[model samples]
Target: MFKTDHRLMGEKEANNSRKNVQMQEINKRPRINLPALRDFLSQFPGKFQRHLKSRFKRPTETEGANRDIFKLKDANFSLEKQMQAWKKNPVWDDDQPPSIEVVVPEGSLCQVNVKTKVGLPPDAVYNIVTDPDNRRVFKNIKEVLSRKVLLDEGSRQIVELEQAAIWRFLWWSGTISVHVLVDQNREDYSMKFKQVKAGFMKRFEGSWRVEPILLDEKLCHPFKPKTLSEYMSCTQCNGRIASKVTLQQLVEPAIVPPPPISWYLRGITARTVEVLINDLVEEAARIKGVSATDLVTTNLNLDQALSNEIQTLDIKERWALRRRNSRVKERKDRF
Candidate 1:
């Protein structure tokens, strides 16, 4: 008897829920208007004018003096006539030159002490030297926007990226020119950048050259006599110095990788990879110190969160696999 009563109560509740849903559907029916909104707007000029003006200013003036000026209907007017009309108009033109141009002294140089030859490859050095982004990389000036490019005699290779002298005066609007030179062998390249018409704090022109030196025992030894006084100290230190010095070590160039078999390869991959790996390792070592073997790690919560995230990802992947299988089956059926 209790089971029968419970079943009856459930059926009664379901019927009541169905009735409530039907009532909601009936109430959601949209009411219709016989007259449209356009008719109402058309009937009221004052309100329409106020609303239209509020929405859009008619890009023209219709006041006492300006009324004649705005009444011209044709969009295509003669340029000569327009110029004549503009001359007659009483509007001020802001495109006038200043009476006295500001004069600034030119030519400046930055004191750059590159300690490691391996720090800059020829191309990287060239790019930094000629790229417009050099300002940001070397100087950290974001406003160094415009630059000009100079090409070789053959008009092929870029050798220089120069900023104009006007650059400092009108920092944003100044012109910059770059000059590039390519010899018979493309490897023999040269670039020269100077502020031509820019107003820079300092103006400078310089060239980069490669030098080679040989490594000797004296140069390699840490305790070897580096100064003349140390050289005179004793034969022990003096014996470390060798007379046969080669021209390879003093100006040793950074190693660059050869081009890959693919034509798409434009840069030295081995050097880039080595530099990136070294930098990453050094940064990691700096951050981690000697904590690799240490047992007391502080990021337990992060480890747990990562584990949970991976599990959730696995579940989502499984669901996606099932969906993909279903789609494949559907496609097969269609075929």
Candidate 2:
């Protein structure tokens, strides 16, 4: 989903020159006196901030060159006297490790919550992941079986989850379950998922912790930025790992929605899909009394139902429709 486009020398030069010309054209135009623009942005929320952050991710040559300026100041700051003073701190000799780390098995369920200083929030993150155009980012994973909103009535929040599977071998593939909840309240936002089943039928569950960190005034600008968010376990069997990135710019426009049933045409998640294929292969082997390989590979259907697309209608709806039919009797029985 995220990739850098490398242009040839000729194309790169032309693009740069074109941008310079456009900038000059804009600068030559009369500017509007909008002192209130800052206030307007300060009041802006949600997608507006995301747009601003996207703009920040782009690095100009001038900004890149400024790293040398910092190098000189850092050289002086790293004095022998300061080094000696830092070494004298007793805390440095403490028993705690410098960083915390943990790893869970491939097929286990885990949950953890973290805090971030700034950058993308839950809704933006959810939008990025669920958006079909961004599906490339999660390529090789299992299909998104479902993404139903958990709270539909007056909750002002929604939980969306996808069940996906992949094909690996004749007897085994992998499957995953991802759930994300976006709350209207700023303080409540989270992403959680698990490798519920795999080729070996292993299960794994994990959650993330997200907290917003406030940047120091001096370091909160375009030239220099700092972030400090607590990324630790809120509740889980093991420790957690996290990746933090500052999205300074949006390289492209947001993706548009695909046609209905597009997902049905292609199973989600390629990596863990082997599980579904393996199931079919096992069945084939049992029927044919031969290795799964004996079956024609071209005939195998990797494109199968996504976990979410399956029928999950409420029982009441089923009964109501059945009552209208004469042959199929509406029963009080419930399954």
**Tens digits of lDDT, candidate 1, 149-224:** 3445452355333332222211133333422231211233243323333232233333343211111224334544
Q: What is the Cα-based lDDT of residue 27 in candidate 2?
A: 100
TM-score of each: 0.22, 0.26
Cα lDDT, model 1, residue 17 = 100
In model 2, where do residues sit more than 4 Å from their true spots? Answer: 1-100, 104-123, 129-134, 153-160, 167-186, 193-203, 214-216, 219-335
Error of 1 at 31 (Å): 99
Error of 2 at 66 (Å): 26
- For candidate 1, give the lDDT of residue 34: 45
lDDT of each: 0.32, 0.34
